[model samples]
Target chain A: DQQVKQNSPSLSVQEGRISILNCDYTNSMFDYFLWYKKYPAEGPTFLISISSIKDKNEDGRFTVFLNKSAKHLSLHIVPSQPGDSAVYFCAACLYNTDKLIFGTGTRLQVFP
Target chain B: GAGVSQSPSNKVTEKGKDVELRCDPISGHTALYWYRQRLGQGLEFLIYFQGNSAPDKSGLPSDRFSAERTGESVSTLTIQRTQQEDSAVYLCASSPPGIGNQPQHFGDGTRLSIL
Candidate 1:
């Protein structure tokens, strides 16, 4: 069973435009959510994360919003750049467990 | 300081053969993890090691799969009598002391192909 899901397989956007990626989770016990970006032949890199206590967190050009009632989270990038082209994965971790459940990932292509 | 490092970036072996994949976590990091990513699929947790504690092997698919870590520095995952279904990119990651809070630094991963 997929605990975390990213419905969109791919997303395309023009440079300097806002890019939004969405994710959903089935487990209510997950207290922490994270986003990772991956390039070809490289491991997933940490992007942004949100705790259950907070509804939103922002880091520079990236922001993550969490909705506990809907079991949803989103990552938004302002004025997305071509360097942002990569696969994005949403992951969740429970309070007691050390393992991370990852989504299928969404491939983002930022066209210059 | 360097991030995680994995060796033998790519390995191709025939069916029924055994293969060993290696990973070196960041210096002084106490937590290490292993994940597998099949083609067109999400990352699957395989195992986790923390300091001198017992490793978590619940995610391992079968008895043929096993892993070992030495001195909280390097880890080796061994797959015995590999099958085609076992082909995938095996990724390794390491984190600081906190669990479920700290971000994990990942290695480039070792791509194993069973022919």
Candidate 2:
């Protein structure tokens, strides 16, 4: 079973526009969530993360919102740039656990 | 290397042949993990090793799949009598020792193709 799900397979947005990606989880035990961005041949790199206790976390142009009640979280990239185009995977893990459950990933295309 | 290192970036072997993939995690990292990503699919957890603790092998899909890590260093994942379905990108990741929430640093991954 897929504990973490990213329903959107792909997304497209114009440069300098807002891009939002969504993810949902089935397990409430997951207390920490993270987002990773990946290019075609490289491994995924960490982007942003948020604890379940907080509703939002922001870093520069990227922001993550968490809603514990709905078991949902989202990553928002404001003023998206061409460099931001990549596959985004949402991951979640339980407190003290070493394994991270990952979503299928959503490919975001930011065009000029 | 500054990042996790995986050897033999691409492998193409005939079916039924055994293949071994290797990973070198970042120095000083104590947590290592293995994952597989098939075309059009997300990363699937395969195994994990933390310090001297027993490895978690629950995610291994079959008895033909096995992995070994020596003293928090290099790891090897071996697949015996590979099948076409086994073809995919196998990724290795390492994380600093922590209770949780540490983002894993991953290698580019070893792409295996069973023909």
Candidate 3:
């Protein structure tokens, strides 16, 4: 069973535009959500995260918005650059579980 | 301060062979994790280790898959008699103690291919 799901397999956007990636979760117990960006042959790098207590969190050009009632969250990258082209993975973790459940990931391509 | 490191970036072996993948976590990090990503799939949790405590191996696929950690620094994942289905990129991650809410730092991962 996929606890977390990223419906979009891929996305393309022009440079300097806003890029949005969405994710959904089946487990309401998850209290923390995170986004990671990965390049080819490289490990995923931490991007942004949001706690259940907060509905939104922003880090520089990256912003994460969470909707608890809908069991959904999204990552928005403003002024997307060519370097922003990578796979974005959404992950969730419950309070007690030390492991994080990851989604299938969305491949983002930014055209310069 | 270096990040997590994984060795043997790529390994190709015939079916029924055994392969060992290694990982070195960040300095002083007490938590380590292992995950597998099959092509065109999501990351699947395999195991977790926390400073001198028993590991959580609930996600291990089968008995043929096992792991070991030396202290809080290094870890090794061993796949015995590997099958074609075992081919995937094995990733390792680490975090500091009391930082479960924080994001994990990942290694480049070891890509294993069973031919």
Native interface contact recovery, all models: 0.82, 0.80, 0.90
How well does each candidate superpose onto the true structure, as a TM-score? 0.98, 0.98, 0.98
lDDT of 3 by residue, B1-115 (tens): 4999999999999999999999999998899999999999989999999899999999999999999999998899999999999999999999987844868999999999999
lDDT of each: 0.95, 0.96, 0.95
Error of 2 at B60 (Å): 0.5
Candidate of highest DockQ: 3
Model 1 lDDT tens row, A34-59? 99999999999999999999999999
**Tens digits of per-residue lDDT for model 3 on A28-106?**
9999999999998999999999999999999999999999999999999999999999999999998777789999999
For model 2, what is the error of residue A78's alpha carbon versus the real structure, in angstroms, after optimal superposition?
0.9
Q: Model 2's DockQ? A: 0.88
Better of 1 and 2 by DockQ: 1
Q: What are the clashing pairs of model 3?
A: none
Candidate 3 runs further than 4 Å off: none
**Model 2 agreement with the true structure over A4-109: per-residue lDDT tens digits:** 9999999999999999999999999999999999999888999999998899999999999999999999999999999999999999997768789999999999
Clashing pairs in 1: none
| Error at A71, model 3, angstroms | 0.3
Query: How many backbone collisions does model 3 have?
Result: 0
